[model samples]
Target chain A: MTASSDIDALAAMILARELESALSKRADCGFQLLSSGQEAVAVGVAAALLAHDQLLCSGRSIAPALARGLDPGRVMAELIGRASGPCLGRGGRGHLSQPSAGFFGAHAVVAGNLSIAAGVALALQARRDRSIAVCMFGDGACGAGALHETMNIAALWQLPLLLVCDNNLYSVSTPRAAALAPQRLSDLAAPFGIEACTVDGMDVRVVREAAVELTDYVRNGGGPAFLECISRRYASHSTSARETRGQQELAADRELDPITRLENALLSEGALSAQTAQALREQVRAKVAAACAFADLSPLPVPEEAFADVV
Target chain B: MSSEPVRTRRVFFREAICRAVGETLDAEPNAIVMGQDVGAFGGSYKEFYGLFERFGPARVRDTPVAEAAMVGLGVGAAAAGLRTLVSITYMDFVLLALDPLVNYAAKARFKTGGQIRVPMVVKLTAGAKGQGVAHSQSLESWLMSVPGLRVVAPSNVADAYGLMRSALQADGPVVYVDHKRLFPTSGPLNASAHEVPFGLAAVSRPGRHATIVTHSYMVCVALAACDELAVSGIDCEVIDLRSLAPLDLATVCTSVSKTGALLTLEEGQVVCGIGAEIAYQAQARLGPVRVSRLGAMPAPVSSNPVLEAASLPDAGRVADAVRRLLMEG
Candidate 1:
C-alpha cells in the first residue's frame, strides 16, 4: 500500500509539473493552471478517496484529476477545447469534469461547488450508498456565502461531506490576511459544529493521513469534516497573469515545495533511487508530450454541434 | 372526446402542484423534493403539505434559505442521477441562484457533450400580488432568454399538473414558474398520466376579430379583456402560451394570420420581455398589419395597491391595448 501510494503521489507531482510546463510554453489560448505547488494536497486527497467517491474540484485544482487517474491526454484535450475533451470543448480548462472518473465537475466559481457537494452528499445518503462526496476549494473560497450556507446545512443534516480547503494563502492576488479574519481557515468551521483541523499540505504523507482520517470519519457516520491544508501557489492565478508577485515571498514559498520534499523523503526512505526517479521523470515528460500532441491534433467542434446538447 | 371515460376534478392551483409533485415522488424511487420550508413545514405557500410524512426526510427534505445552494444542490443531485424538484419560494430570489441555474445547470449537458444530464425541476412562484417588488415580479422572460433551459408558465390548474409531470420526466433542466395570484384560484384539473409538452399554445377563447397572446396569470387577464371586447361585437381570441422557451409560435402565427391582428399581454417588464420576441416574430412570420404588446412598466412593483396596479399589465390594460390595436386597424 505504501509503495503504490508513494509512486502514485510521485506520478501525480510529475504530471502536474509537466502539464504546467506544457501550458506555459503554449500560446495564451485560454488554458488555465492548477499545477505544481499544490500537487501534494490534490494527490493526497485523491489517494485517500475511493474510486466511486465523487469529487467536486475548484477551477485551479487540476492535480486532483491527475491523481484520480484521468487520462492526461484527454485533460489536455479538454484544456484546449477540442471535441475529444471531457466537456466536448463546451467548457474549457476551468470546467474540467468527467463523472465516470468520479470527478463530478471542476467549478470555476471559487466556492460555487460547496452547495453542490452538499447536495451530492444528500443524494448519496438518500440512496443509502456508503460512498461519500468530497470537495476541494482554495482559501479564498472560505469567505464566500456558499461556503457558510453549505457548511451550516452539512452540519445541520449531519451529511457525510469532506470539505478540504487547499489554503494556498492567496486568492488570486489578494493575501489571506487581507480577506479572511480568522487565523486558521478551519477555525470558522467550529461555529457550524464541523470538526476541522489545519494540516501540512507540503507533505504528501501528512496530507494522506489527514485525508484518510477525515474520510473514514465521514464515511462511518461522523458527519462533515473540514481540513485546511496550508500550501502555496507556484504560479500566478492563471497562465496569462503577468503581475509578478514579491520575489521574497515566492522564494520563501518555493523553499517548502511539496514535490522536492516528497522526492527527498522517498530517497531517504530508499523507496526510490535517483536513477529511478530520473527515469520516472522522463516517462512523465513523454506522457505529457504525447498528451499535448493528442490535444493539438484533435479536431475542433463543428458549429452545428453547439445546437445539439441544449436540451 | 376519446372513447375512454375522462376523469376530471376541481382543485386549487396550489393543490394541482402538490398533487403533481406528490405523484412524481411516489412513482420515481430516486425522485426527491427539496427547498426552503418544503418538507415538514409544508412549504411557505403550503404547496407541499404532508409530503414529508409520506416520503420521509430523505426524499422530502427541507433546505436552508440559501437559494444559490438550493438550486446548485438540485443541479449536483440531478447530475448524480436523482430526479430532484427544488422550489424557490419567490421568483425574485432566483437572482441569488442565477450562477448555478444559468452558468451550471442550464449549460452542464451542453458543455459535457450530452455526457452529463441535469434532470432537475426548479419551481418558483412569480407575478404581482401584494408582496411588492421583491416577491411580485414575473421574471419568466429572464429564464426564457436562457438557452438549454426549459421554461414553463402554466395558466390553469390542468396545465400546471401536466407541465409539472412533464418537468419531472424531462430529460434536462426545467424552470417551472407559478404565479402567486393563481395559487388560490380554483380551476378544473385532470390528474392523469398525460404530460404537457413544451412549445404548445392553448387557445382559451377563439374569436375572429383579433388575437391576445399571453401566459401565466396574464392569461386570465387576457380572457377577461376578451369578454369586455366581445360585448362590443369585436370578438378576440385568447392564446395562453403554457411554455415560453420552445415557444409555440405555430399556434400563435396561425391565430395572428386568421385574426390579422395581435396583442401580447405580460406581467413582466416591457424591456426585452417575451412580448418583444412575439412582436418580432409577428413581423417576420406574417408581416403584421396591426400589433400591440401590453407589459408592466420598466419599474419595480411598489407595495401600494394602486401603484402596483398601475405598474402592472392587468385586464384593463389588456382591454385598452386591444382597443388601440383594433382602432389602429
Candidate 2:
C-alpha cells in the first residue's frame, strides 16, 4: 500500500481493535481498559512512529504501546493477569511492559518516563542513529522535576525525543485546574526552551500530523517537543472507581470516541466501507478471544522464580 | 603483593585524578570520560586535565552542567558499547543525576527483564574537608540504598586506580567514589591499572588481636591504629572493604569470625551509616560481638581542623576502640 494508505490502514486497525474492545456488539463491549478518552491520541501518534522507535509510556496512554508494535495479544493477557502476558503476569493492566517491542512499562510516578526516554534518546543521538524515543505522560508529569531536568538536558544536547502529554483534564478525581498552575501542559516546556505544540486529541489525524512534524523536528536536532494532546478518559480511574472524577466521560465520549470518529471519517471519504469496518471489528474480537484462551492454557510461572528479574 | 620498591611519585590530588583518568584512557581505547568541562577546560577538579589534547575532544566530551543528562548519556554510551566514566565533582552533586543512576542505569537490567546491561562508572568525590557543606558530603550511604548499583569507594591512591579499572569492566553500573582527603595521600599500589574485583576485601594489615572493619580513607586510619595498638598489646586486623553493594562480607566475616571482634569506621554521620550495615552483617555471621563505630556524632561537620578530626575517625580512636574491645574480650 502507498504511505498515505498505510497510515489510513494503521488508523483503521487501531480504531477497529480498540472500538471492539471498548465499544462494540460483543458481550464485553463497553469494557473500559483506560480511564481516559485518549484512544485516538494513541492511534494518531503511534501511526507516525517507526516500528523501531522506542516508547517510555507513563501511567496514561495505555493504547499507544499496543499500537506502536506491542503484541495486542500479550497486552490483553497482561491486563487480565495471565502467564502468556508480556509482563509475565507480574505487572497488572496499568503496568504492562514489553521492552523487546520498545514499549517500556507505565510508571505511576509522574514525569518518571521523561528522564528514561531522554537517556535512551541521548544514547541514540551519541550513535548518530535515526531512531525516535517517545514518552507519553499526563499533565501531572509536567509539574515533576524529572521532566524539567530531562527537557533542559535534551534541549541542550538536541536529543531525538518526543515528549507527548495526554492532557486528560484531570489526575484521577482532581481536575487539572486544581493541580497544574498552567492551563496548557505544552507551556511547561517553555522554560527548557524546547519546542511545544498543542493538538486536538479528539481527532487522531491532528495528533498524527503533529507527531509527524515533531518526529521530523526531533530527528533533525530541533530538540525535544512537548505535544499536549487534550483528551478525556471514559472509564473510572480504576476498576469500578466511581467518585465523580474530572472531565465528564459521556460528553467527551460523544464528541471524541476515536473509533466512531475514525469510522465516520473513513466511511465518508470512501476509504473504508462499513462492511470492512464490521469485519475488522469481528477479527479483533476473535483475536482478543484467542489471546484470552492462550493465556488460560498457558502454565503458571515457577513459584521459586518469582523474583527472577528483580535484583 | 607487589615487592617492587615504591617509585618516586608526586601528583597533587587534582593532578593525580587527571593523571589517573589519563592513564585509564591510555589503557583502554573504548574508555572515554564525559562531563562538564571534561574536554577543553579539563574539569572542575582538573581530573580530566590534558585529556582533550591527547584523546581528542570526542573521547573527553564536555557536557552541560546537567547531571541527569550527563549520567543518562553515560548509561546510553555504555549500553551502546562504550566504557564511559562520568564524573560529578562532589557526591552531593549526584542528587541531580539520581534519576538516571537510580531509575535508568541501575534498574535497566532488572526492569527490562534482564535484556540490557549498563556498564558505566560514575566517579563521585565523596566526604568533606572544608570543601564546604555542599561540596563536602558523602552520598555513599544514599548509593548503597539503591539496588543494582555497585558502590565502590577506594580510600587511597591504589584502590582509586584499581576501582576505576574494575568498575569500567563491570557488567553493570558502578558508582566509584573517591574521598577528597585521601586523593593526595600517597600509598603503595598492588599494581597500577590492576583489576581489584568489586567484591574483594583488602587486608590492610594482618593481625589476630581484633578485626577492624573499615573502608576508603578509614582503612589508612585503621592501619595506623594497628601501629599504636602494637605498643598497647592490641594488634588490629584492618580489612579495607573496597566494594559496598556486593560487600565482601566473606572476607570481613572471615576476619571477624577469627578475631571474634569487629569495629566499623565511617567518615559520615554515626546513625544509620555504613558501620551499621557492617555491624549487622558481622554480628549475623559471628554471634553477638561488640562493634565500635567511628564517625561524626549526628551534627554537621565542623570547619576547624581539630573539630573535623574529632568528627572523622583517626588512628588514636581506632587504637582506643581496639584496646577497649580487647579489654572486654
Q: How does each model score on TM-score?
A: 0.97, 0.88
Which candidate gets the maximum TM-score versus the true structure? 1
Interface RMSD of candidate number 2: 3.1
- lDDT score, candidate 1: 0.87
lDDT score at residue A146, model 1, on the 0-100 scale: 87
- The top-ranked prediction according to lDDT is 1
Error of 1 at A218 (Å): 0.9
Mark the regions of model 2 whose C-alpha exceeds 4 Å error after superposition.
A1-36, A78-96, A104-106, A191-193, A239-242, A246-250, A309-311, B1-32, B56-59, B76-83, B188-193, B304-307
- lDDT by residue (tens digit), candidate 1, A205-262: 8999999999999998989999999988888888777646889989999999988898
Q: Global lDDT of each model?
A: 0.87, 0.72
- Could you give candidate 2's per-residue lDDT for residues B191-258 as a string of tens digits? 34466778898888898878888777777778888888888677678888988887899999889888
Consecutive 10-residue window with the lowest summed lDDT within model 2 chain B: B7-16
Span of ten consecutive residues with least summed lDDT in model 2 chain A: A23-32
Q: Candidate 1: where are CA atoms >4 Å away?
A: B1-6
